[model samples]
Structures are given as structure tokens and as C-alpha cells.
Target: MTTQTAKNKAMTERLVEWDKKHYFHPTTPLKEQQAKGPAHIFTHGKGIHVTDVYGKEFLDGVSSLWNVNVGYGRQELADAAREQMMTLAYGSSFFNNSHDVVIRLSQKLASMAPGDLNVSFFTSGGSESNESAIKIVRHYWKMKGQPERKKIIALERSYHGVTMGATSATGVPEFKNMITAIAPDFLHALPHQTECELGDSSAPGYERSIRGIIEKEGPETIAGVILEPVQGVGGIQIPPEGYLQAVRQLCDEYGILMMTDEVITGFGRTGKMFGVEHWEVVPDLMSVAKGITSGYIQLGAVMMTDRLRDELADLSDNVFFHGFTYSGHPTACAVALKNIEIIENERLVDNAKQMEQELWKGLNYLQDTHKIAAKPRAIGLMGGIELLADPDNGTTFEPSTFAAPAVVEECAKRNLILRPLIFGGLNVIAIAPPLIVDKQDIETIIATLSDSIQAFEQRVM
Candidate 1:
């Protein structure tokens, strides 16, 4: 080998060794990864693309775990973070201590949030945001003298987070299988999208599922219902028309709080500032993260309605003990403000709205042309293309066949990265690119998927 080749190989070996020795990656098979190393050692990123250590490029179709809303490598975000760190790097948001950026960021979020969602509680990421929401609402109910209202309900196949409370709240079995019994009183309801599929069944839709649960537990024992406005890890399942509205109505009827976990769909991911905006439904609480700061610095927030905030305030005169050390971190807040400014200044939400049509048109064509594309659906930038062995008969390959992973690999070989959700008997390819993606980027994504699907279909044959 040449000298340059030798150097590259040496670097790769060193990286692999170091990672295997020290880095414990999340959601990875530790033993297998330690033996085989990472699939790609990513080094840098730009708008809509990421370059591996080997200098190969790939479209960031998964938006780097559904964050990076402004796309990658925006110097402005860097500058914003640097400027804030230089000014005020760290400040304890404890004891009513606050930073200017944090205060300003809170005000901005309140103004943008729908209905009376006017208060903000900060965390380090989505998981913490969700866990925090659970505590906040349950605490509120307790203060209101309803200590029995401890049960929480979520939609099946939904993903919340991995913390004890958040993991218990998550509806996916894979997330809970490895662990022991999680937080109690966590329940699952049938998703609205699947309701119509089970035609003529006694159980109709989300309404009945939730209603039945409430009846079984007694409404007085339930604290709240937490759900994703547009399900992400649960196969990008979009709520059917009037679905959220019906849920909101149910929550009201049952005297239970409703929280929408917008961790993945918030901040322009769904062509709107918030996913629930599509239904004009005002949830009592909202869990937000990921796109909040475009993943520049870890930041998450729980936005509460004025009514909920006031209830907590009225019920408690003592210090309500709940918050994170990095809660409302000045640097993160500053980065988030700058990121939101960029999103607004660039009209990224509107761009997402327009590009979604482009995405749907392409996915629709793929669905018609490729028999593997059993059902392709997109709402704004979040979507899924369900793969099947035969669309005519709705024949799906057995999970052991690994068809979804094969299709994802096919896409990656073509310099496009896509997330394949294979668990829970799903063969879904999640499509959620950065909101700042342009028309050309959308076309490239579509073409890449089209070719990948065709290749995968041929390989299966």
C-alpha cells in the first residue's frame, strides 16, 4: 500500500480500537459492535449531508436522529454558542437565578406556543423532558389532593424515552424487555391509525381504547394521557383527521391532563412550529427537544399551559422541588434562540410545507411503481414507506428475513442514510430529513429511495 493508504488504515484501526475500548454507544449491540466496530465513523457535516472519516458523503435522511433541523454545520449556530459561552457560559437556574438568554428564550417559547402554553421547564434532552412532564403533572394532581390519579396512558407503538418513567411511558416492548419492571400505572391504548384497520372489531379506535382504560382504572385514578402528535419511532404514523381533536375531547371529558410528546415533531419537523398545530388542539403540556437548538447543544423543554402553571402555583406555596442542573443552561438557551431565529428568518417551516408535497409526490410514485412500497405516507417532513413482499396481496416477509435492513443498506450504499424500524413487526423506513432541505435535496432523497427499493425487491426475488 502507498504511504497515504497506510496512514488512513492506521487511523481507522486506532479509532476502532479506542471506540471499542472506551465508548459505550446507545441502542447498539455492545458485544457485536466491540467485535466489528462502527459501520461509519462520521467526522463532519453540511446542509443535508454528512461525510464519514473515509471522506465519503451521504445524504442525512434521518436528520441525525431527527434533530439538526437547520441542517448540519451552520457557522451561525457555532457563533451563537461561542458568543454566549464567552458572555455567560454557566449559570445555575436554581434559587430563581436566571440568565438573560434563558429568560429571553423562555419568553420566546411561550409566545410561539399555542393556546395558554406560557411557561417553560428546561432539561438536557427529550428523555428528561418527558420524565419531567410526567412528574410535573402528577405533582400537580397530587397538590390538587388527588393522589390516586397516578396512572398514565400512551398510544401503542409510541416511543417516549428510556428513563425509568419515560421508558415505562413508551409503548414499544423492545425498549422494556431488557429491563425489570418499570414505573407502575403506565398503560397503552390502541392508536387511531390502526383503529380503522381492525374493522368490525368490538374495539373501534383511540377514543374507545382510552375510554375503556379510563373505565377500567376509573377516571379518578388517571393523572394524564401522553402521546406523540405525529408518531416517529413508531413508524411515522400520522394521526388521522379529527384524531387529536377526539383525544383532546376525551381528556376533557375524563378530567385528565393531555400531554403531547413533540420531541421529534416539534420546531418545524412537520412543516409547523408544533405538530399539534395541524389539529388546532391545545394540549395541557408539551415535551420538546431535538430541533429546539437544532442539536447544537443539548436542550429540552416542557411547555405548560397558563392554566396548568397557575394551578400548580395556586396549589403549592412551598418550593416545588423539580429541575435539572443544566436546566435552562445559558449556552443552550442562546443557541436555541439563534436556531429559532435562523428557522424563522429562513422560512424553514414554509419550506418544509412545500417540500413535503414534493416528498409525497415522489413517495406516491414509488408506492405505485415498486411493489415493495406497501404504503407510503408523509405529513410534512416526517413519513414512512412500509415495505412488503407483495403489495397486491399485502404479503409481508417474515421479520427473520431482514428485508428492511437490506433496503436500508442498499440506500446507504448509494450515499443516502435512512433509519429502518424493524422491531414490533414493522418493516418501515422512516423518512425525516432536515427542514432546511431544498427541492434538489428532496429529489435526490426520493431517487435514492426509489433505486434502493427496486434493488431490494429484486434481491428478495
Candidate 2:
């Protein structure tokens, strides 16, 4: 019975009304939603699809906001949460109070994280993970008695998160437009999007960008550089080859910490355990979330290196302060453990590699077909098809045209949903389907997106 009954129908409408009237959604186009009620009153989900209140099912091309790595409605995860709730739901992790689940999860993360990033600090989600990253970076520097090194550098088109600290690091203006306040000393650098196109002769390769920023900001004031190896929300912008290595060398040269925000590219989303592996680079710190629990529960973690840990221990006899009340929540930890187990047992990461090929192939075919001068950019299961304004001229449409949203709406008409990234001169449809997505799923998504692009092209012409 996917259809809502008369009673359920009445309640559903009421709930939609309540949501519009009271729900304060984050990162949402609030004014538009207030006028349109709700785009989807989703009620049920399973595998890679979700059903709405009207019994309409749509392919989750964006993986329900780029998470749900193991797909939706996993019984195993639910069971794990249930068991943990029944056994040990609430336990204080503060003041050295701890639990077994978090300890084990930390050990697992230590084993998985690159380099000596052996410590795990928990948070409620990506925003908090990055929020913690900034604080920990500064606190680590402070403990070193170099309190002046408070500035952070992140790449343009890089998105860390939405918290004050994270928002300051986010490169997209839309994420920061509403905020009247932000943390000071957050700097920006160029992303190596043209490394291949321009070859090594590019004026600002990833290395030069970081070095130039450090030189201008005075490396003494810079604490670290934080960026996504695969810029997910930033149009799934895949960093050029050797980009991570270049940035790593610069950070080492400047005695600055290198941090990777893997909130969107972590887990199996990038066809690797973590996004940094694609470039074979390890950083002093890493912030991760999203796929950590496959969106079953709210959870995030930041990994710290042994060197930083030891230094902080040596310098600070005083207690260090920072953490959320739900940090290492027992139930969330249990679900995360189960989620990882499912990924391994099902071999979702390997599946992602196999499926990613299908995705790119479909995207390549779709982009090449419509004479729209589209570029398909992706890594693993995450990527997008970017539409250009003039195919022959390689120019982008003016911002007033709303090209990306038009594609989004056209695709929606075909029962395919995608996220539109229309910021900082990027006009593309971003997608990160569940790692369990198959070839047919890829074909459908690509076909629908292609049709949308064609429709947009006609309108523009």
C-alpha cells in the first residue's frame, strides 16, 4: 500500500502545510519552497529509489544529497541501531567517559585513514566535521605556541560546509551570502581545473596556487590548507592529475597542515576508500561524513595525525575543549559500523568502480550527442554533465538565463531528479547515485539528463 489512505492523505497534506509553515530547512531555497509547498513529500525508500506521498517513484540520481552509499532502507543498519538503542543508547563521551562502539569505530578508522591520522573526533555531520577541523587546526597550532598561525586556505569552488567556520572556508558565494558574520583569516586559492587543458604551462597549477597564497598571506600566519580532493558540490570538479601531490609538497615546504574534506567523496563514492587515494596523497588531517553511515544516521568524523596528537599532548597540560553532545553517539556509531560492514561484505566500493565506468560512458555519450558543448566530469559514482552556452565558442550562458535549473525541471518531468549547481560560473547537473546503482540506472539518468539538455538548448536557440 504505497498510496496514502484518505486519513493518511489528509495527514500528509497537513504535514506538508506544517513543514512549509514551521520547518526551517538548511541550504534550501526557502522563499521558493514556501510558495510551492513541498517538492516531494517522500514517504518510503528502498534500494536506489524513493516513493513520494503520491506513490510516484523517482531514481535517486543525487543519492539523496550524495550520501546513501549502501542504498536506502537497509534492514541490517536498522537492526544495528535497534540493538544499540536497546543495549546502550545514551552514554557520556565527555570528561573521558567513553563507550565500546566509538572506540572500535575509531580503531577501524585509524586502520583505514592514510598516514598517521590515527585519532578520530566525532561530530553530528559534515558541517561539524569541518567546523571541528578548523578548531582543531588552530588549537594544534596554539598548543605549539604559534598562536599567530590562525589563517586557513581553501580552494575556490571548494565547499567545506555551512557552519560559521566551515562557511568561511566554503568558496561558493551562495553558501555565504546570507551570513552577516564569519570567521576571520579564511583565504582562497585557485583550483587546478585546467591542468590538463593548459598542461604544465598553466599560470596557476595547484602547487603554484597554494604557494602564491602562502607567500602573499605570509606562511607564518597560515595554519593549513583544506580542500576536497574531488570537489563534489562544486560541480563534481575532479582535480587534475598530480594536483593533490602538488598541494602536499607545498604544505610540507611551508610547514603547514594539509586537510582533505571528504564529506562527499569519502567511503565508496569515489571508487576508493577515500578521495585522496585517487592522487595517492595523505594529509595531516581529514574531515569525513555523509557516507559514514550512508545517511542512516547523522554522523561525522575528523581524523588527526599522530604528530599533531603527540604535540598537543606535549604542549597542553590544560584540558582542550571542543565537541558535540552527540559526538560518538552509541546508536549512530553502531549503524556506521554496520554500514561499513555492508560496504565490505557487499563489496560496494568495487561495485562503485564497475558502475562508475557505466556512468562516465553514459555521460560521455549524452554530452557528445546534443551539440551543446557539454563536459562530463566525475570520479567513481559521482559526477555531472555541464552544459555550455555556445558549443562552437565554448562560452557559458549568462547567469540570468537559469540554464541549469531548466534542465533540472525538465529531468524531473521524466521522473529523474538531480541537483543543480549554478554558482561561480558553473552550470551543471550534479549526481552521485547510490553505489549499488547498475548500468540500466546509469543509462536512465544519462538519457533523461541528455533530453533535458536538448530541451534547454532549443529554448536558448
Candidate 3:
């Protein structure tokens, strides 16, 4: 090997050693990480790809955790962050204090948000955003003298975040099982039971639907109904037509607030600027993150309707008593403003909408060519392909087989990064590349994934 190459390899080895010794990664197997070091030490990213320390580049099929809507290495966002930091290195929004950039970002988000969601409360990320939304709804009911309305009903298989309240509201068993005692009053119901949600008691899972849960627990005790417009980490399960609308109506009928977590589906990730636009359903409260700053900076916000904000304002004379130290952080807001500008100027939302057709075609091709590939689904650029041992018979592989992860590992070997959603006995391969991806990029992803699936098939089937 060349002298520089050998030196670089030595440095990478040292870095890996340091990482293994010090870094405790989130959502990773600690023992495995200590044994094998990191899977990849990413060094640089541009457009739809990220390069590792070993000089190997791979297509980021999952947008580095379903964010990075505008792709990577955008100088515009960096410039914006730098400018804001230089002007106001650190400013507190506490005690009614606010900065210019935060004000501008709040207004921008208000304009872009659905319905009358004109007020903004910023947080650092999705978990904080969700935690804030839960608090806002519960506080609203408390201020209205209905303190008993503290229960939160979320859909089964939904993933909100890791914060205490978020963890309680999250329906994914694995996430909640991480802690023994989750916050009380958080309930989960069977998801996508549209007929049951619409008051059809004859539906198969009626008793386990959101409506049934509300009825069983008494509507007056429920504070809000929170859900993702298109479930993300819960296997990218897209709801059926009329499902969101039905939930909206159900919440209205019971006078319970409806909140949608747009952490992964907001800011043009799902064709429209927001996922709720697909059904034209306007939620009472919306929590958003991820695409807000395109993974360039940490930022998130909980948006509520003007009516709700005004109600809370009129009802309480005391302070809101809730906010993060980085709430309305100037640098993060600046980065987010520029990120939104990039998405708009480049018409990436339109691109995502147009590319949905291409992604659908590719997923269908995978299903047709691979016997294990089944139940292909896509909305905008977010999609997934489920693997089953017998598609015709609806039989799944044993969980011990680790079907989806093996396929995703093959994809990684082919220099294309993808995520496998195997929680709750699923074998779903998630495909949500950056919004900046073109038709060719999608084709490359599909071809690589096809070969990867074929490799897995050859091994097991």
C-alpha cells in the first residue's frame, strides 16, 4: 500500500479504538459495538451519498435516519448557521426574550404549517418536539379545568420518540420495554382500523381501535390523540384512504385534540410540504423535526392552532413554564430557514412527488423479480418492501432468520445503505432516500437492492 494510504488506515484504526472505548451510541447493540467497532466511520456526505473513512462511498437510501430532505454538503445551510452565530452566538428565548432569526423561522414555519397552526414552540429534535406537544395538550385541558383529561391514545406500532412522555405514548413495544415504568395514562390502539374509527362497531378490531379505546376509557379522561400521518420507524406503514380524516372526525366528535407527529413526513419528505396535506386533514397540533433543518442542525417545533393558543393564553395568567434551553435557538433556526429555502428554490417537493412514480415502479420490479419481496408500498419518496417466506400464503420467515437485516447487509456490501425495520416480527426493508434524488438515483438504489435481495434469497431459499 502507498505510504499515505497506510498512514490513513493507521489513523482510522486509532479512531475506531477511541470510539469503542468512549462512544456509547444510541440505538446500538453495546456489546456488538465493543466487539466489532463501528460499522462505518462516515467522513463526508454529498447529495445522495456518504463517504466513509476507508474511502468507500455508499448511497444513503434512508437519508441518514429519514432526514436530510435536501441531501448533504449544502454550503447554503452552513453559511446561514455561521452568519446567525456570528451575529448572536447565543441568545436565550427565556423571560420573553427572542432573537431576529428565531422570529423569522417561527413566521416561516407558521406560514408553511397546515391549517391555522400559527404558533410555534421550538425544541432540539423529534423527541423533544413530541414531549412538548404532549405537554401542551395536557396543559390545555388542565387550564380548561378538565385536569382529568390526561390520557393520550396513540396508534399501535407508532414511534414518537424516547422522552418519558413520548416513550409512554409510543406504541412500539421494544421502545417502551427499554424502561420498566413508563409514564402512566398513555394507551395504544390498533392502527388503520378506518371503519372502527368511523364508528362502525362491526369492524373486526373495533374494540381495539382508537374510538373503542376512547369510549372504554371515557372521552372526558382523554387529553389528545397523537399519531404519525405516515408511520415512519414503525415499518413505514401508510394508512389507508379516509383513515386520517376519520381520526380527525373522531377526535372532533369527542372534543379531544388531534396531534400528528410529522417528524419524518414534514417539510416535503412525503411529496406535499406536510403529510397531512395528502388527506387535507388539519390537525389541532402538529409536531415536526428532521427535515426542518435537513440534518444539518438540530431543530424541531410543536405547532398548535391559533384557537388553541388563544385559548391557553386567555385561560392562564401564569407563564407557560415549558421550554428548552435551545428552544428557538438562533443558529438552528437560521439553518432551518435556509434548508426550507433550498427545498423551495429547487422544487424538491415537486421532485419528490414526481419520483414517487419511479420508486413505485422500482419496488414493483423488485417484487416481481424476487419471490421473497412482497407488499411493496410508497408515498412520495418514502417506501418499503416486505420480505415473506411465502408471499402467496402470507407466511413470514422466522424472526431468528433476520431476513430484512440480512438483505440490508447485502445492500451495504453493494455500497448502498438501507434500513431494515424488523421490530415486532417484521421483515421490511425501508427505502427513503433524500428528496434531492433523481430518477437515475432511484434506479441505482433499486438495482442494488434487487441484487442484494437476490443474494439473500440464494442464501436462505
- Go through the candidates in order and give the clash count of each: 0, 0, 0
Taken over the whole model, the C-alpha lDDT of each candidate is 0.89, 0.86, 0.94
* Candidate 2 local lDDT, 7-34, one digit each (tens): 7878888988999999988677889889
lDDT of 2: 0.86
- Model 2 misplaced regions, further than 4 Å: 1-8, 193-208
Cα RMSD, each candidate: 2.2, 2.7, 0.7
Candidate 1 residue lDDT tens string, 314-429 = 98889979989999999999999999999999999998899899989888988888877868889889878998888789888898778888889899999999999887888998
lDDT preference between candidates 1 and 2, better one: 1
Span of 10 residues, lowest total lDDT, candidate 2:
193-202
**Which residue pairs collide, candidate 1?**
none
Off by over 4 Å in 3: none
| C-alpha root-mean-square deviation, candidate 1 | 2.2
Name the weakest run of 10 consecutive residues (lDDT summed) in model 3: 81-90
TM-score of each: 0.96, 0.95, 0.99
Ranking by lDDT, best first? 3, 1, 2
- TM-score of predicted structure 3: 0.99
